[model samples]
Target: MSEAPIRLLIADDHPIVRDGIRGMFTADPRFEVLGEAGDGAQAVELARALLPDVILMDLRMPRMDGVTAIKELAKLGNTARVLVLTTYDTDSDVLPAIEAGATGYLLKDAPRDELMRAVHAAARGEAVLSPSVATRLLGRVRAPADPLSARELEILRLIAQGTTNREAAARLFISEATVKTHVLHIYTKLGVNDRAAAVAVAYQRGLLTLDNG
Candidate 1:
């Protein structure tokens, strides 16, 4: 049996842009454009009503912006993953969208293949960002001071080196519970919510030297 097509809702203020996106997805058998909205409010309403598998949202729509829409949709308990498509690639746009619960961010000029890949990735709960944007965002942020104790820093360095928490604990002669506490502290100090972000922060802040392997 064939797999179900990925259901999508497209939201963009510009008719031509929305039409272009609609045409691109219509040509793909793996995707189905379930609905289209010309503004953020309509997008939120349609999303709540349709419950699509994914939403392709443009950031600067009139009436309500994509970020606001994303925030509101999240509050409504909508399950659809939001994938932000916008011309802005700066940290200002990318970070706010991510904080608003967007699962992915893609440039509006992204090739059809990349867009499709992002949509599918978002559907699976993975975070995606344009390479250039990711680089810029990662570069600007300074790493926090070693919030963890000296012992905890040792464990985090090991974890950043791909060691399992249990492995790190054993190597440190500490219990797994202690390692977990350190890991939590690392996350808190970094203001990051996931392992990937934590790793990026560690690498950028020089907490984990690249040659630590």
Candidate 2:
């Protein structure tokens, strides 16, 4: 006998985006569009009511954001796996949603087949990430194994504190060029692209602490 279609709840603030996602899922026999939510609060309400197998969540929404909704679902002991479907791929966006119990993260631009595959994987409680996101996260996962040097960590902490290269150089008694090199190395070791992402990832990975002022 054929298996039951995977039930889905799509939550996005934009009507067109919602329509597109709903149409895509409804066109496939393997999936069913159970409901659509325009904002995170409504998404949470629908999720509690419909109990879908997976929720395609958009991060930037009204009333509440996707990350907050994911956290709420977890607090309520909702079993549905959340698959973040948003335009954001930054460290701040990706890490918080995952830490909040998202089963997957996929960009809004993902191909239909890939999105389908992600939904299937999420329904099975498997973790999924977009290629770019996976690459960034993989760097983070492998970072602890390689470990950052002491100088790199010092520069990273200064970066986290909003220090410019020149300022960091002065603070550490190093040349500006040396500080810039250390910053780049810290970025490489943390699997991030800039000062903000580096700081965010560092906090996520426990490489920096809250009380380390």
**Whole-model lDDT, model 1:** 0.86
Clashes of each: 0, 0
lDDT of 1 by residue, 13-91 (tens): 9999999999999999999999999999999999988889999999998999999999999999999999999999854
Q: Give TM per candidate.
A: 0.66, 0.77
Local accuracy by lDDT, each model: 0.86, 0.90
- Best-performing candidate as measured by lDDT: 2
Among all candidates shown, the one with the greatest TM-score? 2
Where model 2 places Cα greater than 4 Å from the true spot, the runs are 1-5, 27-31, 60-63, 87-96, 109-114, 128-146
CA RMSD of each candidate after superposition = 13.2, 3.2
* Candidate 1 local Cα displacement, residue 173, angstroms: 57
